[model samples]
Target chain A: MLYIHHSICISPQFTFPEVNLEELVRSTDHKLYAKLIVNPDIPPAMLRRMGKAVKLAVSASGPLLKQYQNLEGIIVGTANGGMEDCIKFLNQIIQYEEGVLTPTNFVQSTPNAIAAQIGFLSKNKGYNITHVHRGLAFENALLDAFMQLDDNPGHTYLVAGIDEISDYNFNIEYLCGYIKKEPVDNVHLYESNTHGSIAGEGVAAFVVNNNQKGAFSCVKALKMLHSTDKDEVEQAFKQFLSENLSDNKTVDLLLSGENGDSRYLDYYRLMEAAVPGAAIGRYKHLSGEYQTSSAFAVWLADYVLRQQQIPELIVKQHSGGNTIRNIVLYTNYQGLQHSFILLSKS
Target chain B: MKVFVTGMGIITSIGDSVESNRKALMEGCCGIGMLKGFSTRYAETLLFGEVKFTNEELRNMAGVNERGVSRTSLLALHAFKQAVSSASLSHEVISDSKTALIVGNTVGGMCLTDELYKDANQRDTGSEYVASYDCGSVGIFLQQKFGMKGIINTINTACSSSANAIMYGTRLIRKGYAKRVIVGGTDSLAKFTINGFNSLHILSSAHCSPFDANRSGLNLGEGAAFLVLESEEVRDNKKVLAEVKGYANTNDAYHPSTLSDTGDGPLLAMTKALEQAGLAPADIDFVNTHGTATENNDEVESRAMISLFNNKVPAFASTKSNVGHTLGASGAVEAVYCILNLLHQEVYPSLNFNAPIAGTGLIPVREYSKAPLDHIMSNSFGFGGNCSSLIFSRV
Candidate 1:
């Protein structure tokens, strides 16, 4: 099991900086942009050069990285890594016909930039890596952290999941109809029965280690599956729950990543069926749908595990978290990637 | 549990099959030349290690009728099929839940970013290119094609990507997560990368010269390489090419695009790999250095070698001198090259070297020679200070 020391998330509803998410916020447009919370400690000069994802990524985990000086590593999972900067450079290339250009955008364009920036800022110079496997990105990063921590007991590591939407992102995703073109009332996302979900972006950073001292909870097990069939997903989730859970422990809170995308709600229904009578919850409404939106669900798992109540979540707490002990997060992205994380109150 | 390389395949500017590439390396042939397989203004000015086949030609060879598949995935599919066939693995075995697939890539469908941009800019009903842009798209395509149900992942640590992919595959087998794992990487010449490297001014005007005193820059190459890694327990009578003895990944964290002058990351990675292998530096017979031929890489790498080898560096060379720097694919390419050398008891020569650096004065192998080799160390370092080293020992 991996211990979660600090889990911080920055999203549109302001999940971080210890804000009280009393009333969930909704985006007037289909795209839900994150309000960046910059770190004052980072020099303005350095911060100016970082893209939105990089800036918020470092800010979300900056404190934990600083507190734990000798970290084993920083691993990040991202789908669209600074594509805004990359597209800007490509545009420069086209506009200049390969004549005039600056190297800033190109340097920040690589997907590892987020993890590397954290190391550059902390100057730890340890193992830094990035995984860009679409929906499974965060789960892979968490697995890396878990495996690393499991290998070396008591070692601390920083793991994060980040994806940001650019002004052009929604339009591009809209062309494929992967994102809804109409303005989405994230509050009433399921009511529209639209063909696609809203475009959203956020970053969640966690300090995971082998030590459980002062930790919020423990990541008991993590399982990921890639499938195109709803029945397969249902069976895989049932198998995952049975295999990962010890002592036949029952789930107290189960968060379903139902984004209300018409094409994918059936898979979500199947997932819900896998765990009957569990205290069901929904998060994509608050964070919208993105590649690593599962990270948002993880942060919520920690929140509900500690707060003893859901924070304005959809369905308004299905059964109970009054004495919640096991929080199972089952997230499916685009009906192809499925993940289950068993979080326990250690 | 030891990880053994049961089968491997590669497609590069040098050649596509193992034997052809071995012949080129033995003859000290250089594949860096005018770019081909695409329309780019750089075709007239810059050099690239582009494979001989065009995208359509590769798709036809791989029998992939899927629309909008990028050249990156095509090259990947080409190498992947060869590796699986060479391993004598059945379709059922490859599709089993005990088999894992991992691909390391920095360039995904962005090789077709031109089409992606056209689709995005025009917002004309979505193009097939949209479905191919994700970094995971390549692995997803392979999984769907083979029905692979095990762990599937992609690593994008710039140049060290495939080395990390190989490392992750080894870990999966060692941890019993899979009986066998296919790990490698792919990249194709893209206008996006050409312009990106051009803006950085790191594209060499001529063929790259590694460890040379005045090495200019890197020649961006395009290709793919894949290796079927199996646990010793599940070798299934397959010929053992080599044993994955040790590996390590470390970050310099000193700069975004440059390695530290001290070569701290490479030094640590090499040291850790040797420790894991339980082999001393002297046990290694040859070192396939990262040797991107950039002003920074050769110097930092040389410094690291001197420190690790205690001034008695092993016979070192950069096969990148033959295939040019294949970016994300270089690690696995060089690993397979090392396995070939280990299997043949020989070493390939580095091309275009006249003088040594001022202080290091370390020169790479200048000629092909038949030397009894037991272990080979392959190094791959990338942007963002990602450094990885793999140790391959004769089984």
Candidate 2:
């Protein structure tokens, strides 16, 4: 059994520990960058060298590490990691024509930098790894944590998903038709009849343990698939549910990765149909869309389960329950990689 | 719960196939030379272990006619196809939806750094190569081509990427998530990496000499390698190459680019791996060391080995001297080399080593010799203090 003890999210919404989730922030930028609540506890000397993504990751995980002890490992999932530093290094290479270049950008550009930074700050010297698969990145991290907890049975793990937006990367996605062409308020994200969804970036971290005491929720099951066939996805979903949940129990809430893009909305419809009795909710409108946006949904699910209430901003349809109990989070990337994660209140 | 290696395939600077790579290792052949496959401004200054194939030739070798396909993907496909064919895996088996594919890569399709520069500058209106920039693109291409329906993941932890990939695949099998997994790594030489290393001042101008007293730095290399790992039940009359006895991963939390002088991460990794395999220090017959020829790595690694083995270290060698450090592919490439050692009962020589480091006085295997070996260990340490070790025992 895997249980989540603590979580911290740095997203477009007010998701920090002190902020009220009921207050939503509206944005019209092409890219919805995360508003991080800087933690003054971190020394200024250490904060001076970190990039935006690194700072967000370290700050978000800092409080959790303090609250929890004996972290056995750190696992991170990122699609585009340290993009600011990567672009800086690339620009220097172009400007100098391969002459002398600074090493700071090169040093911090790797995808594992965030994980390594967290490990260094926490002083935990156990297993550390970074997963970079497009959509399945976070699911892979979660699954690895689950397996590790299963094997050890009592150790705590730190799992996180982080990504940053750079103007260069956002422009590339815009040109490739991955972001909305026209600027729209993020509150009206799903209402636009557009070809692409709004671009967003954020970081989310969780402290996971095998024990359920003082935990917000327990992870029941997690599954990932690379196929796009509807029948195959449905079969995998049914098999996963049967293997994890009892047949008599039904999911209380279903969170779908339904962006405003018409091209990929049918897949969400298919998933919603699979669990017809559950209340439907959407998170992209609040968090925007990224490869690892499912992580934000996970944080949201944990919050809802702990608070025993669903915020109106995220509720797409009310069907089965007045109180949150069991939740399923489903997300896919460009109709290629699909993920399903089940969570229940503790 | 035993996991076995059913098949292995590789393409590196020394050779293109497993047989050729083994032959080159036995014959003490070095593949480091001036860069010829790709044009770079540093072509005349720095040496590299290029794969000796142009992008066009590699595309033809991989039977890929796609215009925008990167060299990284082509190299990966070539090795992947060889591994699948060598294992006699049928199309039905590959598309079974239970076989996972886990790949590690640092420079995915960004090998076309110049094209990316142009595209980023808006000089071109979304080039076809733009889609191949992310690290997941290579794995996605392989999954699409092979029609793989199972779990697919990509890892990038600098040089230790593929070692962790192998470890992750084993865990998935042990946990009953997948019956079989295709695990490996691929990286192609690119200016992005070359310039990055150059800025760090760790790129050697000559062929690297691992563990030598007067070693300068590391030479960047590129290639791909894959191993087919299957559960014991799925082995099903297949010839088992070797058993993945034990594995462990640890972080130094020391520095972003260098290991500590005490070598805490490497020591812990090797010790934990040995403990997992239910073996002692004396049981390991040979070791494939992560000797990158840098001033800091060779000494740190030597100290770690001496500490773990209590000054009675086993015979060891560094293949980086022969093929240069292949970065992300170095881990799996070295793992394949370890497997070959167990299969042939031979220890390959470490070329370009004349003397040991001054402090630890550790000497690598200087000559190729045939020996009856039962178990071997491989070490891979990456930037950001990521350290991993794998033990393979003869079945």
lDDT by candidate, in order shown: 0.86, 0.88
Q: What is the lDDT of residue B97 in candidate 2?
A: 79
For candidate 2, what TM-score does chain B get against the true chain B? 0.98
Encode model 2's per-residue lDDT on B232-314: one tens digit a residue: 99989999999999999999899999898889999999999999889899999999999999999999999999999999999
Q: List ranges where model 1 is wrong by over 4 Å.
A: A246-248
| Tens digit per residue, CA lDDT, model 1, B235-309 | 977899999999999999899999999999999999999998999999999999999899999999999999999
lDDT of 2 at A18: 64
Over the stretch A291-330, how does candidate 1's per-residue lDDT look in tens digits?
Answer: 8888888887887778777665555347643687888888
Compared with the true structure, what per-residue lDDT tens digits does model 2 show for residues A206-270? 99988989998988788898877878887888787777779777888999888888777778888
Score residue B379 of candidate 1 by CA lDDT: 97
Report the C-alpha displacement of residue A7, candidate 1, in angstroms. 1.2
C-alpha RMSD by candidate, in order = 1.3, 1.3
Model 1 TM-score on chain A = 0.96
